[model samples]
Target: MGRRVIALKPLSKENVTSFYQWLNDPEVIRYSLSLFQKLNTEADIDFWYKGVLRDTKTLSLGIYVDEEFVGYAGISSLSSVNKSGEYYIFIGNKDFWSKGVGTEVTRQIIEIAFVEKELERLMLTVSVPNQGGVKAYKKAGFKEEGRLRNAALRDGEFHDKIIMSILKSEYKLS
Candidate 1:
C-alpha cells in the first residue's frame, strides 16, 4: 500500500467538533495534557483555535491524513530571542495509533521550526509511560535532557516526565 498523505494545515472552526470529541475521549487524552484542561464545549475549542491564531509566537496545525483530520501538532511559547519553543502533538484518532504518523508529524514540525522559522531549539515533555511518544521523538532526533520527578498525574498516581530537545545545529535537513 502507498503511504497516506499527511500534512499540517491551518486549523479551522470546522474542526471544533472533532477537537471536542477527542478532548472528551478518556483514551485519547489519557497521556495528554488535555486531561488537565476543561475544554468541555465546542465553543471552548473554537476559542482555543482563535487564541492560537492570534498568538504571534504560537503555531498550531491540524494533522490531516488523506484530507481527513486525524490529529494536531504545534509549537508554543516561541521565543525569537532564544529561538526556542515547546513542541506538542497528539493523534486523537485511535485508528492512526502505532502507524508511524507521529514520527512523520514530528519530522515535519522540526523542518518548519528549523528551516522556515529559523528556530534554534525545540523541546517537548512526554510522560515516561508514553513509550510510543518517547520512541517517536527519539526517532525524530530529539535527545533526552532530563526527567521531572513525579511530574504528571494520571489516574490519581504521579508519573515522571522526560524532557527532550533537538537543536537546529543538530538537525540534518533531509
Candidate 2:
C-alpha cells in the first residue's frame, strides 16, 4: 500500500458522528491512550468536537486515504506546564493499520508543531505493546526519552508507558 499525507481539515457535524461511532470500538481505543480513553457519549463527543475545532495550542487534522477518513493527528497541550505541545494520533480504521498511514500523518503533525506552532518540543506516550506507534514516533524524529512505570493497566496486566520526545531546536523543523 502507498501513503497519503495532508493537512487536517476542520471537522464538520456530518463527519463528527462517524468519528464518534468509530471511537466506540475497543479496537480503535486500544492505542489512543494519550487522549482520553472514552468518547462514546454524544455530549462528550460533541463537546470534544467543539474543542477540537478551535484549540490554539493543539491543531487537529483529519486523515484520509482514497477520500475516506481513516485517522486523526493532533499537536496539543500548549498550555501545559511542561511548556511544550504533546502529540496524539489515531488511525481508527483497522484496515489502514500497518500500511504507513500513521507515519505520514505524524510527520506532518510534528512538522507543524515546530514550524507553524513554533513549539519548543513535542512529546507522546505509547503503551508498551504499541511497537508500531513507537517506531513511527522514532521515524518522525522523536527519541525514546524514557518510560513511565506501570502507566497503563489493560486487560489483566500493567503496561509501562514509552515516552518519546523531539526537540524543535535540534531538528530542521523550523
Candidate 3:
C-alpha cells in the first residue's frame, strides 16, 4: 500500500468512538499511564471526552491518515505563566505503528505547542518498557529529564516512568 498522508485536526465527537476503542485496547494502553485505571464503559469515555473539551489548558487534536482517523494527539497541563505544557500522542490503528506516524504526530504537536502557542517547554511521561515510544520522543527532540522510580504498577508489577522534554529554544523546524 502507498504511504498515507498524515494530518492533524481538532478533536470532535465524530472521532470519539475510535478514541474510545483505542483507549480500551490492551496493547495501546500498556505504554500509557492510563493502564493503571480501567475504562470499561461508553459513559466513561464520554465523560473523558467532555472533560477534554472543557479543559481550557489542553489542546487536543485528532490524528488523520488520508482522511481516516487513526489516532489522537495533544498538549495538556499548559501553564501560561510558566510557558510549559505536556505532550501526548497515540496511534490507534495498529497497522500504522512503527511507520513513523507517532514521530510525525509528535513533531506536529511540538510545532503547535512551541511555535504557535509560544510555550517554553513540552514534557511527557512514558513507561520505561515502551522502548519505541522513548526512542520516538528522543527523535523528536525530547531529552530524558528524570525517572519516577516504581511510579506505575502494571501487569501486577511496578514499573518506572521516564520523563522526557524539549524546550522551545531547542526546537528546530525540519
Candidate 4:
C-alpha cells in the first residue's frame, strides 16, 4: 500500500471544538496523559488555544486520512538546550490504529524535524505498554535510549516511560 503524506498544518479555533470532542472520548484518553486531563471547558479550551497561537517553539499538526481529521501530532523542544526535540501524535480515531497511517504520519513529521528545522536529534517518550507507538517510532528510525521507572501511575500500576531518540545521521528514512 502506498503511504499518503499529509502536510502538517497549524491548529486554530476552527477545529478546536473537534479536537476537544476527540479528547472527551475515554478510548482516546487511554494513552494520552499530556492532554487527557486538560481543558475540558470552553473557556479553558480558549485559553489553551491562545497559548498554542503564541507558542513558537512547538509545531502542531492535524493528521488527516481520506481528507478527514483522524488524529494530531506535534514536535517541541524538550528543553532550553535546543539541540533535541520531542514528538507526540495520536491516531485517536481508534478505528485507524494498526493501519499504517500513524507510521506515515511519523515519517512526515520526523522528516520535517530533520530537513526543515535542521534539528540535531528527535526524541519521544512513551509509556512501556504503548507498543504500537514504539514500533512506529522504531520503524521511522528511533533507537531506544532508556527508561524512566515508575514515572507515572495509571490504572493502579506504575508504568515506566521509554525514552527514545534519533539523530539526523542515523535516520535512513528516505
Candidate 5:
C-alpha cells in the first residue's frame, strides 16, 4: 500500500464540534497534557477556542484526510525573541491511529513552523508511555532532548514526559 495523503487547514468554528468530541474522548486525550481536565460544555470549548486557539501567538490547524476532519495539529508558545515554538498534534479519529497520520501531520506542521513561520526550533513533550507518539516524532526528525520526571499525573500515578525537539537547520522536507 502507498502512504496516505493528509492536509492541514486553519482551525475554524466549523470544526468546533469535532474538536469538542475529540477533547472529551479519553482514548484521544490519553497522551495529552490536559488529560486530567475535562471540557464539559460547548462553552468550555468556546473558551479554549477564543483564548488559546485563537491567540495571535498560536497557529492551530484542523487535520483532514480525503477532506474529512480527522484530527488537529499546531504550533503554540511561539517566541519572537528566540524564534522558537512548541508543537502538538492528535489524531482524534481513532480510525486513523497507527496509520501514519501522526507522522504525516508532524511533517506538515514542521514545514509550516520552519518555512512559513520562520521558527528556529520546535519542541514538544510526550508522555513516556506513548510509544507510538515517540516513534512518530523520531520519524519526523525530532531528537529526544530530555525528560521531565514525574511531570504528569495520569490514572492515579505520575508519568514522565519526554522532551523532543528539532532545529530549523535539522529539518529537510521530503
Candidate 6:
C-alpha cells in the first residue's frame, strides 16, 4: 500500500459545511467533546470559524487528503511562558478513519509544534474508549501523562479521559 498524500492547510470558510456535518455525525462525535456540543447548521459554526481564524494563540488547520477537506487539527491554549499547548484533532471523514491518517497528521502536528513553532511541550486529552485516537497519539510519541476518571459524560454514562503529551526533546521524526 502506498502512503496517502496528506496536507494541512488553513481552515477555510468553505470547510465549515463539512464541519457542520462532522459535528452532527454520531460516529465522529463519539470520541470527542463535540458530542456535547449542539450545532444545528453551518451557521452554528460561524462563531467558531471566526474565532479560530482570529485567535493568535491557536493554530487550527484543515486536514486535506488529495485536496479534499476531511478534518481539522489544532494546537490551542498556547502559553509562551510555559512553552506548551493543548493539541486536538478530528478526522471526521469516516472513509479516512483507521487508515493511518490520524497517525500521520499527529506526526505532522508534533513536528510543527516542536520544531517550526519552537514549543517545548504539546498535550492532548482523549476519551479512554477512543482506542484509535490513543493509538495514533502513542505512535507519534505522545505518552499518557494522566487519566481523569469520569471526565466525559456520554449517553447517560461517564467515561474516563486520558491526558497525553510529547516534549520537544523527546520528538524524533520518523
Question: Best candidate, lDDT-wise?
Answer: 1
The lDDT values for all models are 0.87, 0.76, 0.85, 0.77, 0.85, 0.85
Which residue ranges in model 3 land beyond 4 Å of their true spot?
Answer: none
Per-residue lDDT of model 6, residues 29-121, tens digit only: 887655326765666677777777889998999999989999999899999899999998888899998887788889889888988888999
Model 3 backbone overlap count: 0
Q: What tens digits encode model 5's per-residue C-alpha lDDT throughout 91-156?
A: 889989888788888988999899988999999999999998998899899999999999988777
For model 2 the local lDDT of residue 94 reads 85
Residue 67 shift from truth in candidate 5, angstroms: 0.6
Q: What's the CA error at residue 38 for candidate 4, in Å?
A: 4.3
> What is the C-alpha local distance difference test score of candidate 4?
0.77
User: What's every prediction's RMSD, in angstroms?
Assistant: 1.5, 2.8, 1.5, 2.4, 1.8, 1.6
Give a tens-digit lDDT track for model 2, residues 104-164.
7787777777787777788888887888888777877888889999888766578899888
| C-alpha RMSD (angstroms) for model 1 | 1.5
- Model 4: CA > 4 A from native: 1-5, 78-81
The alpha-carbon deviation from the true structure for residue 105 of candidate 3, after best TM-score superposition, in angstroms, is: 0.8
Task: Kindly list the per-residue Cα lDDT of model 1 for residues 92-139, writing each as its tens digit.
Answer: 899989988898899999999999989999999999999989988998
TM-score of 1: 0.93
Error of 2 at 100 (Å): 1.0
Model 1, CA-based lDDT: 0.87
Model 2: lDDT of residue 104: 70
Candidate 3: residue 106 Cα off by (Å): 0.8
Clash list (residue pairs), candidate 5: none
